[model samples]
Target: MNLLNQTNEKIIPSLFLLLLITGLFSCTSESELTQVDVVVYGGTSSAVIAAVELAQSGKSVVIVSPDIHIGGLSSNGLGFSDTGNKEAIGGLAREFYHRVWQHYNDSLAWNWEQHSDFGNRGQGTVAMDGESRTMWIFEPHVAEQVFEDLIAENKIPVFRDEWLDRETGVEKENGRIVAIETLSGKRYRAKVFIDATYEGDLMAAAGVSYHVGREACDEYGEKWNGVQAGVFHHTHHFQVPIDPYVIPGDPSSGLLPKIADEKPGANCSGDDKIQAYCFRLCMSNHPENRVPFTKPDNYDPNDFELLGRLFDSGWNEWFNKFDLIPNRKTDTNNHGPFSSDNIGMNYDYPEASYERRQEIIQEHANYQKGLLYYVANDERVPEKIREEMKNWGLAKDEFTDNGNWPHQLYIREARRMIGEYVTTEKDILGERLVPEPIGMGSYTMDSHNVQRFVTEEGYVQNEGDLGVHPHAPYQIAYGSIIPKKEECKNLLVPVCVSSSHIAYGSIRMEPVFMILGQSAAVAATIAIDDKSAVQDISYLEMREHLMQKKQVLSLND
Candidate 1:
């Protein structure tokens, strides 16, 4: 190794430096660093799919995930499907559902719910198929099994529970990511990198710009932008006014603990507050294998007064949405004012640290579990409602290892990267054109409440609820996944792609992410072949590959 001498001059003690020393040195040094054709960050459903596709395409690929599990929400408890237009799905995403059908092919898979009773209908779309093409709904283990099968068949490399160096890990030269260093001091080099995390952590760390919250309607020409007051969906609003002060009726007591001290944003503008998050719990009626709801150690009965008020006002019909998956488990979600979704309490979660995020996740779990415990045991919850709550318990066959609690918490919206191409509501609503289409997304632009605060008028109110339909399937641009060529050329982002809060609401689903992941792999392969930037990858070539791979691009006018 040569060192710079005094005065910082290139004191080349050139003793016959004619043997191509630097070239050989680079070859020897870089060889030790692990290299792959593709490196996918975030072990989400999409990241796994991307790795499998690239490996199947005869290219070496590796997936590095922060979480221990493989699948994102799909392998988590989100077994209940969220498909708006089922026909719009194709490619690997369709294959995922098809694999679920194969799992249920064995008669033993029906041990939980009745063959006829196990309904696959979600909203207007049917998640199951008698034709055996796809059975979209499944248990957590079933989903995990399918992902494992894909990994095994493709022989893809996967490193679970590997966190990326959130700062200063991305090594970029000539506008291309040459390699990335994880927190474990291991370096991974790849021709192309795909950010497949919901939080957009890797993308953000690589200097890929990303948006955090919703944009105003005027900013993007969107109809359903900004704070929507008086628009209550699924019974999470405050019909009565409750003061934000410490006391029940006093105004001079100042803001309470849960309510933030900052002023709420203008009604027409956007804010950083994201919608609520929850766990897609799996519960069963089988008492033998059931885990009864236990009071959380940090449970506070006062945290449930708002729910008690909602229950008192004749909203006791709790079983309105106990969507049952296979293996005697139900993918139960929030229903009433105080349920699984800790609305308005998870605003700062998307951008928080892992440890901080865990705190938030546990906070939600405690709140949700407390809600169940309260409804089942508390005297104020009404006898009829209490009885119904008591009968429900965690499914034993599902998440059997850890007190029957869900391993994954539904992080609905986290850190969304402000990428090269922002996918605004205008694109999904068909009001504006999105260039360089990669895949399609067809789901409702749905956002849960972000804040559940008592209004100044002494009534309770939940804010940050917006629901709009993406009337038809719309194309997602390839540019949305990558940074500008000047910023980083070799990175592709699927989960945290550029989208307004409204548009992300529709595109954030796992199936869409999987489809985009396959498309990103195709683009990466093409980029590697041509030695081109991610932005410079020819759409003609990418589009051809996508069409050949059966990944949907556009819908007919």
Candidate 2:
């Protein structure tokens, strides 16, 4: 390798060049070092909102994102936001929806469908409220544009395609992160740091305590913590007595692909398994901007044999949650039995290597695409259902870079920080009161199916599908976002806050993420001002700052 000499000339095989480089072999240059007041990792909606809040507070912040896009699922195909209580949503989260409302108010946004034709279908409130003028459901591109506008308006620096060096790149001093080096040879030094990634990569790299999977019910003294098998509140599981074997009545023929041969564990027991993941497909029926669903390259009909058996057994709820948005597009989520959710395929995603994670993502994509193709084209499907499925195709204008596919997958839950305070089912259901309110979450304790295994009586069943409801809007504590006092002094985790697996199910909504993002930024600024650890900052001061920014810290606020 060649290096620059003292005269700024290229030299090879010289001790002078080695000394100039400052190491035996180093890929990074001092010019790539960035100093900022705050360094926010991950490019989710929370990251964008936190960076904006930091910039508004006169702090230099940089967003280091692994993905190409900024907004995670909010700008990805989850246009149909899963907001439980609109009153619980305030601050930058509400501003985002308000901007979405303003976009649809203009006549030019109504290209595929007329403004009058796309009526209000949102829950909890009127869709087109001339009063609040906040539209919840919208196209994917509109949400991305809104997030982009937030970054542009605040002049926040965002570095995309920069993966953190998880192994040895984090430089720490006195229980605080001094700087972080990325895989692209870029280093960032900051006084404060916020980890907004759904996977909690930065927090884990900082040696923060975190849990990957479910906790036993006894561990948190909560009722809904682990291994829930027969609780079928949603219609996402198999509804029919379909055989899971490759052969109808022959056990020697072996179980079908993707179905585990082991028996499912007892209810409420802990395991390392995580919920399934799927792409929030943006499907449209508008012929002008619809790309007909095409079969993926690795299409295999036998891969979806279980779904065919479900259809043959009279379980036909193919369109349970095809939530429609503006511009005739749909936020097509995993609906009925054997829908878009690729079960038992993403168990190792939270801890997988970068290359392995990419493989898992591609596997989920192929599974979902094959499911759509099977519904639209397979001869074995019911004729009427197949015809209806044929009507919906991917929106052409959305996700233009990836052939009408979302850039990010829905990572429902990952490494949750076991910080100073842990939110549990009691906190979510209003049984346990939470102090130091920073934000609120009202969504149901919802987790997708985790494992597909054989039952005791020789039948296939899914476990870990939970849908319990919270009593009311509950406050998330300030201590939940900060790491444990002994682990890290300056880091804050908003997305993967300290919580039980079931509590995280409720706190994992996009709006709650943005709310906590704002709260985390305020807390970081307070810590920086006082020159104290994040855990040592005053909760009341942080709350006052959040309230000034119109953030609803508690239900009473």
Candidate 3:
């Protein structure tokens, strides 16, 4: 209930003053205030658009978020978009793209590069005019600007830095969410609630069902499900077998730090683990905004000796991966053996508390930063590779607040809600038909490496990387977003919707989230009218609304 500063100093004065100002300036209409049609609990792209849609439809709404920076990953450092099918996007989701286009209307937005070089429209992501326009991909600041414009246009009340109370704060009465309380003890009452968090923390706190890691192939009848020990791509696990034991070929050095200590669970069993996480770094070649990588206080180059071993083992194909973002910035994700992805290091993060989560985040930062610093400085590194790595530096304009680290990490999959309709691998493979259709997802079933361990031949191997294609964009089920009808009837979740780990790989794209967010709002409006649970809302009505909004629901595309 108390707001503590980073130094643990009680910020009672400013907290009280801000509260007083909000109270005095707050809308006083008992009719104009109190209840809203919906209360979305994240400032993510989906949440923002949901609020915008409902408000645009003349419904009242509010967004409560723990992050002061809105737009979640979209507005954060992930400007290099993971848009599977640009044609699948529509409605407010596509409008977000248009807004980005509007930003480029001014020549100044292209400060880092020539507008011509920026290209014409995003690759294949068509504009509403049915014209090819370069709008889907954008820079960090550009994305934030678009989201801010939507918020201002809608006038939706956004309470920043409001951490939800996971226990009793989600007061459900008569199978409906009445109000939600944050960590600061402020209660926000509403007719319906939507959980848009990536972790689905609020959804779970509301007594909704959810799942956390990969389901064995048998559990979900999925080909790409479970431990993918035999699969290796983009990077070499070992043309030669790596020893899973301790001493390299000796079996006595004690398993190197990164390898698992136990027999990795049977290939097809459910486990509480997820793919490795790493910062979706936005590095700028621009001298003005770039910051050189720094040495950490706990600068232990030995922690990354595993990578050094990989380099020595003849794996120097660097540019084959590390996706490019824009304006001299790179999304620079995890690639190569022991690169940026902090594999096997962040399993407990999905459910950890703020302090604990911060610890994990900081540890990851140090680990990743140390990796860069080591590659750029360590004499152990191949001289040629070190010179190539040195050319890359942190983008200056990105992550200005933190020392050039991304505000968000590529949390590939986490806390998936067990909703009314669970989207399994069958949905992606077209083996099982989903009855309720809200939006569509058509990317391949993709889960990154969950754990990295030394093989029997003393080489490091990455496990749980599933790349089995679903052929084309598949239909994401409405059931995936709604919890079991019996529990919390009115709540809808999109980002953390129900899906097996392998199945979620396809649904977990930024464009899909935005499309789902728009669909979630349409459902919200319907739920308000019917005075029923989100699950009870008529799919026929919902489908019509979505078509009106231009959200691609069918796989016909």
Candidate 4:
């Protein structure tokens, strides 16, 4: 294997340099030595929780992340917290939110708005719990600070901006990862490994089996696994008929920009297309804290023509879900048919190269920024709607280094590991009891639109917007987090657990990730102690360990 630059040019070193680079293997050099009991990958909210749990379990650990900032969506403008059934959340996940509550208790934390003015509000839940003293909604910085405190308190080593050298970095011996290296030539040798990343990058590099896209309903016996067209139960579908063509009523003219010309697939067939990804914008209307929406440098009016048409069709519900956080900030997520989710454009992101991923991120940023500018200033927008939109802008104090923009994109679904068991709709709906419960996921099986295409009737429609409520909070199986017994015995996956697309939609919440992360760490420590594969660990012992950590394994009657 060779390390290639962006242009695919190889950089070869002299034999002496090669010897020096790999000297730790031959000469056991101390400088190149990095040994730990547990090595966690990704800087997500789950990653931090897992690292803390490992340290608390009396084990040495390190966090290897490609991001400059940690906490993933929790600190990336997802302050509204997409938590369902908070009672199901326990352990480190609840502690993180409690920390957020503690931060806001300080009078200095409320800068833009008075604490009284920002009354308790959350998505179908209580924002503040007096008895628990935990705040579920907060500004982005508060969440980041809480994560930083977790790291500082534990004294866990972290190496940020270290991309995994996927092709040749992971070294394995007899189907077990012995050591892994990063693109910066940093190596980590560990007894056990956990892939806590949303993308499952480390698991993939270690040759673990995983699935990328939706599985067919037939394949998993799931009701909502595959391409779902004509499933317009939400307001996210085009409310009124809108012509997708550039020149209305003329077939010769091309379709409007951003409106795909492809035909959406059969209703229940599997495809390689993933759900849309977007930067959850943190916005505010306060005069002191608001930075007015600025037109992106590559703004294109034609990109959002369909939105103008929606406005003309008497669809003015643009602010339906501008979920408010503390300090006058809003977690602005995709609300309607044409919103922040750059649908269909992120199909290539899950497996794209780092350079290509950056380009895709920039494109999403430009598109969302341009959409805000259009809604605020475009003449085609309804006067009343434009006026309301003009009042909201990016928060001035948040993401100060990135021009008040979110640093992380909401990767709703990605590469899911195909492990010992796959969590399907049956598991989520409580039709089938998952054995060896590790954690619980109660969020609705929510998936954003996957494709926006023209219908046979010549109207634009968005497919794959699904929101099905589960019968109750369901237990996540321990087998779902461990890879196949034959593939990789020492590795555990938390963020990208084995699940079908529809089930993962519910399990993909940040709180659920943290819960699974803590569970993963417990299992990892146990596996190291037993000197056995993660799949071979005793389920009873795992459940007992999780319960000792305050994890809720089974639902109460």
Q: TM-score of every model?
A: 0.90, 0.94, 0.91, 0.94
Better of 2 and 3 by lDDT: 2
| lDDT tens digits by residue: candidate 3, 1-557 | 11222221122556435544654223344322334568899878888888888888777777877666678788766765666677666788878877776776667877778766754433334322226333666777678778888887776667777777776678888777787877665677777788888878788888888888878788767667777777764453545455544456666767666777654676777688898887777777677767888899999887867777777767786554455555766767666656777878889888887677777788888888898899888988899988877777898887678666667766777798877777888888888777877777777676777887665545667788766677666777788888888888889898998888888888888878888888888888998898878888899999888888888877574
Best by lDDT: 4
| lDDT scores of the candidates, listed in order | 0.76, 0.86, 0.74, 0.87
**lDDT of each residue in 1-557, candidate 1, tens digit only:** 01011121111335113212432112135323556778899878999889887977777777877766679888878888887787777788889989888878777788755667665665566667867478878888889889989987876656666677777788888877788877666677888999998888878778877777777779877767676666765455555444555566665876554455544566758877787788888888777767889989988877776566567666665776688777667888776555677766777776776667777777877877887788789998888878877788888777666667776778888877666788888888888888988888888888887766555455556777766787788889887888877778889888888778878888988889899899989988998899888888789988898888888776661
The stretch of ten residues in a row with the least summed lDDT in candidate 1 is: 1-10
The residue-by-residue lDDT of candidate 2 on 26-139, one tens digit each, is 334655676778999999999999998998997878788887777999989998888888889998888998999899999999998998998888755666667887888888
Model 3's lDDT to the true fold? 0.74
Candidate 2 vs 4: which has more lDDT: 4
Query: Residue 167's C-alpha lDDT in candidate 4?
Result: 85
Q: Cα miss at 359, model 1 (Å)? A: 2.1
Model 1, TM vs. native: 0.90
Q: List where candidate 2 sits over 4 angstroms from the true fold.
A: 1-31
